[model samples]
Target: MTYRKKLIEVALPLDTINKESAREKSIRHGHPSTLHLWWARRPLAACRAVLFASLVDDPSNDLPEEEAKVERDRLFGILEDLVKWENSNDENVLGRAQAEIMRSTGNNPPPVLDPFCGGGSIPLEAQRLGLEAHGSDLNPVAVLITKALIEIPPKFAGKPPVNPESRGKIGNEGNWRGARGLAEDVRYYGKWMRDEAEKRIGHLYPKGPNGETVIAWLWARTVRCPNPACSAAMPLVSSFWLSKKTAKKAWVEPVVDREKKEVRFTVMTGEGAPRDGTVNRQGATCLVCDTTVPFSHVRAEGRAKHMEQKLMAVVAEDERGRKYITPTEQHVVFANKAKPSWRPEAELYGKAAVNVPLYGLTTFADLFTNRQLVALDTFSDLVSEARKEVYKDA
Candidate 1:
């Protein structure tokens, strides 16, 4: 007897598979892709079809043309049902596909292994079809994600959560299926952690001028003007436009106090267009003195830690929409209050690929402000506490 071809060797329902795969990206709840940011993640639709077809055999050539046509149509029907995103977890659909896999393999299909599984798509789909699935990767993050998607779920699949809050809420024990309890525990503990973080650092984020909650503060990096006669801190910004939407035109206007030799920025809204930004390819123009400052001077100032950040705008949200505020001394004082104790002093990656190092941002920690660093440190400590809580619940 000659070896026959597998169903995967033949054509697939590409249009149906592609359309469903595109729709899957918008599915946020309980999806493994949301576990982490893995580039070029293999879509579930493609993986499911691939696994099913690889196991089942196509019709042999020796059969009559009509017989071969019927067999091909039967296999195509299985594929059409298999690639639908909505039917991924449907027991009846999965059962039909799994039965076909068993029949083709003589009830002894080989275990699936994905040695370089970046996002656990292949192994997860294999396990979904009731097969033994194993996954590995060079990246520890990928390995952790794979374990969460395939390994850890089986151990906690049908169990009720041990956490007190979730345990109180869950009614039927039999209804607890496929990590639902685990998801509830996560939400409950996650809210608790957020509350704790707010208690610790709530004072850092003050409301905007009208008492609307201040969502974000915009700032521009500055370096002292090279001209001694007009030593103003010049802002290096590419554009002044805040919002270019139809009637909501807004931009920044730099007000130069010539006596004090300072450049203060104000938010401008409505029809009138704002002036071009200071920095360009060659150099920056001093807002106060109109003197040309070279890029070399700015680079030197950055290297010497003399570069400063000036708040340009304050973004706050109200009942209607977002409102931008002109910077005030009080708001400036709130920004100055942060003094972080920890920073990532590790060197950055290769200089050839990265451009920030040329302007003194040579470390990973340099990318964040002191306030942001403090928040990150607080969250890092809270993650450890959350893990301990998980251990207690388990």
Candidate 2:
């Protein structure tokens, strides 16, 4: 058998491919990154180009050097078109690339396999080129994201919107091609889930004092001061800086009251946020008695259930985009009242991820507040219920 090189073994127009790959991570419309967070997501554009190059020959079939150069340049032109994010769904562009693959493999192109698939980039690209795509992974989350991407879409490609509201609006406006119908249903039912959730647990998240919608709550993990004379609730905040935007600079400043033995947090804006934080790997500094608190003491407090969380600041959306404010009594009250039924309890790994277990946040659920747990459990339930609704509509 004569040895013949593929385009992957030859020129690949790499610089153009790299530019396209880098742009895929941006928050542009309809990117797969918007679908889910998978740290191992490969660049779909790079996957598309490489998969095609792997299959198609490089015109190395004993042609004259000049003729081979011409043919190679032609394939480079096709790859430039194929590797584009905009041309991903361009049928003419994809059809030409697939045709070349068929021509090379004698119309019996082998199915693509991604044995370690994370976020389904490779198989998704394989399916883009009209090839049978199979993906598998040990991580269940990866498997779920991959299955949602590769298994579901093609099954109903070119189908019309099934939901009644979408059908009512999509009346006589041509077929709902690709995943347009499905995407519309997603928008519709995603809104439904959100509305339903608000009705159930809307009060858990309250508006700020001035009636601004609360965007976030900055929390500080706390342990009692090691100094027996001071014994104040000392905060374990890594950073007090909330926002560094020149116009909206914000941070939490701790106010120590000597007479009351209390540490109250104040939300401050503009020039003077504290230069240093409360805690680092070695230890923390108690603001009250000026005692150096050791990490070992913090761990002891956590083990003894003496550690607590304090509301450092309230982030709210206002006319000015965002504003940091001191936490209101009402906001703190609502947070403690949440009674969620279920929580995931998984032990932490020391060297694998973070040393959280040392601080007695032993399980995954222990890391979140009760209100946060309620929201998580609510969203998880709604997803299941929403799936049933999609099925009924389908």
Candidate 3:
């Protein structure tokens, strides 16, 4: 009944837990982990395993050794209940776990603290194991997330949302009560916000031929040929491949109309489509006088084209999922208008802010067009209004 035996019990079920966790991924649509994209968040399984292991003690080889052995056996039964509970949300198993935790560690379990809790994974798992958990982080965002997980929920325990939506079968079956109803409110409001945003800024994001919403826009650096005779600027694009997959593979071939002194992005299909080796391999040549241009001239020296208005690809999504479309010259107009107004200060608190000035990026808002700005501003206003409304109702 040493700590080694206790460790074995904890470690034994991990393989099954890991497999179940991996399977849970496909059905984790409403999981709190998906609420926000936190960087380097620990897996729920690891946190659960470590917390359970630390909470319980093994049999002591002393006067109370026999009593300790009996408690340890009961704890082992609780461990089994925990494994079952993790796999399936059995209320009976949870009850058994709670009873065993109280039996082994008395009514008050020792509190677990994670000071630098980035995503609040450890603390959340600790709380799930029926332990009082305290978490903190230097980052305001992290702090807010931890509060949402640990502090906020318990305050509203056994209570439904202030304005609970009609849950039909989910509510009738006793599934959407307590904290679950609060989650529903969040989802409801979230959808409302998304719809509001779309109504305001839908013009900025256009639909493709299949009516798929645009998800991403790609851009490339452009440079001018230094050869004085040519004096022409061209895009420093290495590859024009939309995709490498056989089914939907496509590419853009630069049709240099020397007579017209222009280059056109012609979508190539079928046998004409370039393979990986040939794709984007060609260097930019001046449309006017056919002189080679260097990428260094474009990126470092700001040669040839206008700054920050390069549109390369328009990625769209629908029922079939995402597809990349080669953007025409017309699409570049929307992005070119998104120039920044103010530049960041060269120094902050006497230290050189080298990166900001080096890249010439002013602010996050500076990277949008006037229309986009209006749309974003309107959405922000709507969100503020909605939040205030929610708080008032609450």
- How high a TM-score does candidate 3 get? 0.72
Question: Model 1, stretches more than 4 Å misplaced?
Answer: 1-8, 29-32, 53-84, 170-172, 207-218, 239-294, 312-334, 349-354
TM of each candidate vs. truth:
0.78, 0.86, 0.72
| Winner on lDDT (1 vs 3) | 1
Report the C-alpha displacement of residue 171, candidate 1, in angstroms: 3.1
Candidates in order have lDDT scores of 0.83, 0.86, 0.61
How would the candidate models be sorted by TM-score, starting from the highest? 2, 1, 3
The worst-scoring run of ten residues by lDDT in candidate 3 lies at 274-283
Off by over 4 Å in 3: 1-10, 58-90, 164-177, 230-233, 236-296, 299-305, 328-356, 366-379, 391-394
lDDT at position 1, candidate 2: 70
Cα RMSD, each candidate: 4.1, 3.2, 5.9
Mind giving the per-residue lDDT tens digits that candidate 1 earns over 1-394? 6786787786667787788788887774556557777777899888998998888877764457679778878877877788787888888889989998998888999999989998899998999899999889998989988887788878877777767776666373647777776766767788878998999887788888778998888999998888889778888887888888767787889888999998888998988877998888888888888887788888888888888899998888999888778888888887778777789888888653277776888888898888888889888999899989888877
- lDDT digits (tens) for residues 352-383 of candidate 3: 33343333334454344555666656666777
Q: What is the lDDT of residue 5 in candidate 1?
A: 76
Per-residue lDDT for 173-214 in model 2, tens only? Answer: 577788777677777887899999999999898998888999
Count of steric clashes across candidates, in order: 0, 0, 2
